[model samples]
Target chain A: MFTDCSSSTTSRLIHLYNRNGVFLPRPSVSQFSLRTTASTWRCTLSIRSSSSPSAIVIDGKAEAKKIRDDIKIEVSRMKESIGVVPAEDSSEEEVLKYVSGFNDDPSVHGVLVQLPLPSHMDEQNILNAVSIEKDVDGFHPLNIGRLAMRGREPLFVPCTPKGCIELLHRYNIEFKGKRAVVIGRSNIVGMPAALLLQKEDATVSIIHSRTMNPEELTRQADILISAVGKPNMVRGSWIKPGAVLIDVGIKPVEDPSAAGGERLVGDICYVEASKIASAITPVPGGVGPMTIAMLISNTLTSAKRIHNFQ
Target chain B: MFTDCSSSTTSRLIHLYNRNGVFLPRPSVSQFSLRTTASTWRCTLSIRSSSSPSAIVIDGKAEAKKIRDDIKIEVSRMKESIGVVPAEDSSEEEVLKYVSGFNDDPSVHGVLVQLPLPSHMDEQNILNAVSIEKDVDGFHPLNIGRLAMRGREPLFVPCTPKGCIELLHRYNIEFKGKRAVVIGRSNIVGMPAALLLQKEDATVSIIHSRTMNPEELTRQADILISAVGKPNMVRGSWIKPGAVLIDVGIKPVEDPSAAGGERLVGDICYVEASKIASAITPVPGGVGPMTIAMLISNTLTSAKRIHNFQ
Candidate 1:
């Protein structure tokens, strides 16, 4: 179970979960079939392996639902709906005005601006305009700066990266003293993920386009996270025996057998990695759902902090 | 040869410096004797080596002076004095008020609050109050956030980390694809230095107190930076032969023969590391001076940026 808890709370919960021996086993592939929807692409987890796969399949969809359920209980207990202000298709100035309005509104707890603004708009400027307190997306420079600093905590962490760590915590994965390698250095997923892992006491190495001998470094990782958005860039050979894998890359690839004639694939070649990795997150059902779960969690958190609610 | 230059400009300068074959040699211990004064501690560089030191001594003090000279020329050309407002021994609210005043002041280019504020003062809150445009100290979370993000530039890089990188640039040390290890995770130095090294395209690993086998990881570094302030903590066995070492740690230890009844030392054991490493920085004269130089450089850059002075 997951809560919109701080690091200390999360650590305590992790210990409680471990002491109770409540480790959730990899659900059978059949269990996932019932959960598939049009929004979530259909893919057979067992089919990814050429032979009987030894690795545990991390059911991120299930984990995300559990988190949402926990959040739902918390929200209902608060007995108040948190307001989120979203402005769409507006000029930069117009969006800034809307953000300003939300900043002053006592009822509005969070404000999020959609990314990849119009070519004429300055994205950074628009993002910077949001009040840091209402920056639930955690893209604000101040929040990120605090996240990067030791002995400091950001008001919010980027939802996607927070979700990735949440999955690890829920699964009782040990991060301390681990050799962790992050593939890609993107601001959204890779960079923040690396920072979060480092904060968790893992020795982290970040590999990007300029990195030499990436395979050599990847082979040393006890845990590996790939977020380069490249399909099948990481091969099974790159995996160290029994390494935990978190695949954040999701790309639609040609697949005639699929319902939509296309299917989602991750950075890791899942067919091969499942045999070697001790645990792995699948493409569509993994980090994708967790991102949404964390956004909702952040909004709830923002509301609580704003009202000074316990 | 050092300028208050952007990364691109520094890269170009490094290329030019490398092509000209003008790398400065380690100054004789006697040359340093004349430069020492009451403010600066007197320490012999070669004396750290029990035998003839094969490693090149990175003369950070000399390089810092060169940087200051460049800034001096730039300041004269600007023909304007950049006003810096410093607040001391103020309550949190008082410091915030001063910061707000400086933020509104047109002539003020920078606002710096000396660290380790009174116990009643919230340091992060005070630091965050500074305007991002005038945060020459780069302690502002916004600046740090921008620094951590890819394809984004911070208004200012933190002085100590910036100084560390500047020394590497001036000495024409290659960063791309190298395995860089940073010891410590302090906000002011270790964390930012690791981020800067990663930005330079070095596959970087950060080792902190919780690291299980720091020596094992340090041995893999082609470039190692030790910022943990424990004196002589990093031994020769921890260093990889031919690696470059940057010691940011400065701790005064007991030395009866020294002038003040004590002398400064770095995290690394200079006597042992000099034999194994290709180059190393001496504590008293290394990162300390470069920090001051970067502060002056940042101030000048802020002024130029505020005035649109090329």
Candidate 2:
């Protein structure tokens, strides 16, 4: 069904949280956060791809962990310096109220509502409630509209798609004039990714379920980005030889050989595609980790913008 | 440049004004423009291509003129029935003030700020002032963002792009699975046209100035939509055989032969394109006329939505 890219199948793209990742400025964190600490950004250290010398294995897991750790340290340090405790958010309404308070608070530079909120609450309303200036996730329609429009800049870009582009930039992959195909059209990932690729001067084509010949269309791509969360849906045949593949799909599949009878896999058939694709991102360590790193990056950027720090 | 999709090279695609028929919604037009009295919308009476029987010539100019006439009749009739005279607006700030008043006045269905505002005013600030419900131009970021999104719908669509799609639909030109190429990335026409094409299930590609080999990209398209406003930039050689061409470029060109010493042209080489493609929209009679028609249509839709008169 995933191979079909069919209408019957629904896209499972959703933003995940690490319990504390969503609601930032947890009154427990310090107001003195983002205090002009000039540490090397250590964004990435390129490790040559095991499969191809031209490709690099992007270690997103390590980078994401470092960012989380960095944020934690900064929060603790700020708490010690500024000494402010965030009030408890006991309910969904309380969580929203807390977020609203942060919107006006100059100290709080970013705000985000984790996706898949307990079904009762309206997702659009919560995302809309975040002040445009503080909307670090960039889920707000205004931010997205700004991103899509020419001569307009969004305050923030959605993290996963941003991470995908960041990986390409960090890796020095040139996609100009190239036939780039983005699989899936979920608002958060595929659509924005296509826009980002276009911004980079790539000839972009979006492949969705309605596509009459998805395989034929995909095979023409010099840069193929697959975000449909169906494991191993893209085979080696679907990709052009030497094409750069950015696989944003992640889903748990049954595997008796693993410690748990389940293993995480991406949309692309990594084993076979590695032979044909010049470069490719692996499932567990791919766009997943970079997403969190990008969130922190956006938050830092917001703080810098708010404080007018270079 | 205005009629030939000429080689005169003047139109570099700057957003234009009423002087060239780009912006619609002249204030002299009555406020009760689109009173919905359901009659079969005489949208199109497609004329088969003189060059090819399979191709239908979309007469946008006649349709637009008819629409304007219809609107004039309805607006005049309604103004006579419900007596409310709209105040005149002269300055930029006054124009903004007038629009805001319309926004709050439930009687006023849609509001639009004509483009190419005078050099002194902040265009974005003025546009942001319009209420979302009343933003008939569909230029507002929120509306655009909704259009870009998968599960969201904009209250209105930008006219030119919407006209392009409506032509394809009204003419029964198939879009699904077609490799559609959109030239240019302007927010007003090109970007939205690309998005609308994608929504119609075409595997869409966008080509801009930075495109290394635009010809190569365009050759792959089954449907080519050019809105670059660069006079006759696209040659007959650039087109694929039997491709569907929708040229959105309109610029006035200097011509010594004409009495006025000038003529209208578009972005495509119409003479060349018409010979090569199975279907093509003429420079003056094509996308231009449909734009105004769409504005009146959008206004009518807005009125219907607001009044629930359907």
Candidate 3:
């Protein structure tokens, strides 16, 4: 998880804080605190995979790589067609350049950034900085605020949640009047996922850590999407038979039994839940692949709009 | 509702989006096919109160007045004690000044803006502009974001929801492990209120317009908070007898039989809900008073903090 991006920026601040007691205010520092303190170090990140083990891998990493390659090809094509350029510098700069270019190009339909960016970056600020026209991920506060309000539609949705809904759409899962429970409320995944589910006309309820008796509520869900990063936090007892389960959690678990003494798992106990639920997504290959696929879709849409392709 | 504040020298941006075609984008004109024919016209401003015999008066006008008076007294005292010049302009101005002042003054603690601001103004922009420190309403995005995350507390709770919870707290209602359903996910009321209930260890569910089978979920609520602006949206049949109800809506309903053509009403059918509910707040006298009282409390806290008072 410590990508090359993490070392260059926040390491400077950490070095300063260690050497000198005076900690200067950097927006990056607060984000770093949120990342290091909240997700990785404080809790167990992984668990065992499937006990039954018929599950297919989602392969988010491979999917993301495929999407990035497609985007690079499209960017070059746009240049060939109209002399427009996609930035080769920072992802933020590249996103801004495409969004800013939207004023002149009505054809450019989408713009998106890959998620799990370096923790030091302000996600919301960077997302909002994307011009509204090219906001393929639709993570901007304006888009989020619009999505939250009645009678408004976000131009684009965050990739992971969008992928979840697309899965339902592709599988022809009926959402109308269905009781749905979203077990997270992050701006990136759970919140938008719930909104999309509601847009599909499902009766949605959000249960977070503060929610008491989450299992009871989950047991009632005909459709459940769990994005709480906690590994195997959801038990088999929580599944409502015939319910469609989408597990978005991907945790790295340490186990001597597995390769390299570690393995990936999801929020739900796959063995038990799969037995009861009608359909369920596996940790590494299910929701993960869809996320990257949607990212590619969003980027292609953006490029099409930029090139004015009908 | 707008009022002249007791403060001075508060700079504010009064945004005007003319409904009379001042800034309708060119594309919208093309869609309407009235680009040349469109002409500006001054629209009549009216506060069209509702018309319902069973209306419950919310009394925002009285509540806001009382709050302002209380703030006036505190501002007078601060002047006497610290010689800090308190600004007086308008309701919007007062909120801005206090928020801006609170940002600089280490002593200031809490700040709030009275709700039902003039319809001409942009509510979200104004609310978002309030410094998070003094956001007593807790409507600011940053504060709301923090509240949504686990292990976080807002600087101040939204007064309306806080008042609703205070009623539950005072009445010895047990929400812990109890299922609570909040209708409406507005940033100011519903969303934050659900978060607050969850923080109290209640199993909380939020239902908005997009929710399907809202009535079915309402039946599951041991505690219900309805802030859906629709008057009498939550019927008695929807409520579970003995369930505690907090009606946060206060809409004016016009009645030719009454002295004025209009009177206040809540989102719940008060007569029906009161009969079924173990306890219920009267629209005019219950949550209304508590909200204003909390605002005063927040303002006093701000002043004390500015003065470094323990």
Candidate 4:
């Protein structure tokens, strides 16, 4: 699901137990310890290919990388124009640094932290700790609440959901007065995605796993989206002919023949769905890039507001 | 729709203006005319009745009033025991009086401001002004954002959505691994409702007006909940035979021959849906009351936390 990267330094581990009247565990390599060396370690998890025929690829991975590149460029521009810079560190210290740095900076606008962060971190606590003014991800409770309630607009929208709407807009898909079915109920994707689609004047319905007969329900959708992580769960027969399908699931299943012993897949069976659906996104390229692109967009928006930039 | 409570009390108008400066035209409405006496005003809207009916009443209005009465009683008991009162000031004078009267009293743990304030008001700024600790409605952006993100729970939840789940729980509706369809995408009822349904381990999908064929999609729901405000928009044929229907729409349609010249209705066509569906919630008395009751529950929970009485 993710690439693991490790870089090592020559600095020795500091065991500061009982320092400043605080008792803490000593820094020692144990069974649970992460292996490290002076250089760097990078491993790309490959997806397994199914025996099934070829399917349409929704390339989210490539899109996410492109967005990251874009952000890197904009970040450089900010540093060039002013002394201000977005956090280079992805730690709590980096969060604090940006929080205090953006206090009065006229050059920085929005701030964002990538989602699906490491399991040890609490997303809300970290989001709350970030300056609300720069919370470009809109994952903060305040932003979400504002998005949910009327009369308040979110400073930032969750990236995946934003990407979903953006795709519809890009593809010139008509949503007004049309019946839409959104599969999955994740807050970051399904919930906000439905809200955005509804805002666009679509009569929206949310269908989840609890739905008794999903295939029957999905067959009615003119526009269908699946964000749940179950690979190949939505079949071609599930979609109505000429229906627009957006698959948000990205997973790696085992494949012994592939280069990496695995291959990527989407929530919908791209092969079968593409034949029946009018428009479908490819796995790996479709929605993957939009999240980070939206992140950059949100960050720039936040920075613009903070700096009062035209 | 809302009633016109316009009055001739200049001072009172001024008071409202001062209290909600964000939405009011002027910081002080002392310069405008106001009504000195309160008058009865009612909603004016109508919906077509079903030819033959079968839906059971969900009864939101009765439930809300009952919950309010319970709150009033509890408020009295709290005041008698701890010499503190909940904030109820809608005017400058009352605000001053309450602030002075409750100086530093920590006994009042939760403060909830009932929603749907007069049309001449700013809901967002007013709700924002509530103390974070006493924001029982969870309408605040901070609270909403937390609710949207994974692993972050809001201290409070919006009342109606909570009530919907409460009914499901009370009735022992099996939600786990079931497919649920939630119609509408409103902030209060639709968006949060989908999230709550998903949190209960059901696969969820959201549909709205843009949906091309809602009837076809709806027939697949094991559980169907409609929060769309349209009167009797959902028909009997649109539902699955055994699907559970939770209608959140409460509209008062024009009924010239009826008492008060109006009749209450729901999003679903009651009679037809009830006959076709296994169970359905009626308008007026259904989800409406649960909102207020949940508000009370949130308040009590907040109070217990504040007083360490739980």
Best by TM-score: 1
Residues forming the 10-long window of minimal summed lDDT in candidate 1 chain A: A7-16
Question: Candidate 3 residues A1-310, lDDT tens each?
Answer: 1212121111111111221332312122112111112112222222322344333333445545666677687777777887755333456555555456664566554567556455655567666666654555666654554565445665566888998887766667899768899987776898778767766767777776556557778888988999866555676677788888899977665444567866776777665566678877777877888887786677666556555654
Superposition error at A269 for model 2 (Å): 1.2
Interface RMSD values for all candidates? 1.0, 1.4, 4.1, 3.6
Over 4 Å off, model 1:
A1-47, A80-100, A105-110, A113-134, B1-46, B80-101, B105-134
Tens-digit lDDT track of model 1 for A124-243: 887788877677588777778888987788878998889889998988999988989999888888899998999898888888877776778888899899987655567777899999
DockQ, per-model, please? 0.57, 0.49, 0.16, 0.39
B1-310, model 1: which lDDT tens digit per residue? 3222111211111111222342221222322111112211212222354457788999999999999899878877766444332334457888788779879988876665444466888989977898766776787777788889987788788999999999998889999889999998888888899989998989899888767767878898999999877555676778999999999987665544568855677877776788889999987898999998887787667657556677
True contacts kept of each: 0.82, 0.69, 0.28, 0.82
TM-score ranking, high to low: 1, 2, 4, 3
lDDT, candidate 1, at B98: 76
Evaluate residue B211 in candidate 1 and report its C-alpha lDDT on the 0 to 100 scale: 73
TM-score of each: 0.74, 0.73, 0.60, 0.66
Q: Against the true chain A, what TM-score does chain A of candidate 1 give?
A: 0.73
Chain A TM-scores, candidates in order: 0.73, 0.68, 0.66, 0.68
Question: Model 4, which residues run further than 4 Å from truth?
Answer: A1-98, A103-110, A113-135, A149-151, A203-212, B1-110, B114-135, B177-183, B201-209, B222-224, B228-230, B254-257
lDDT (Cα) of model 1: 0.73
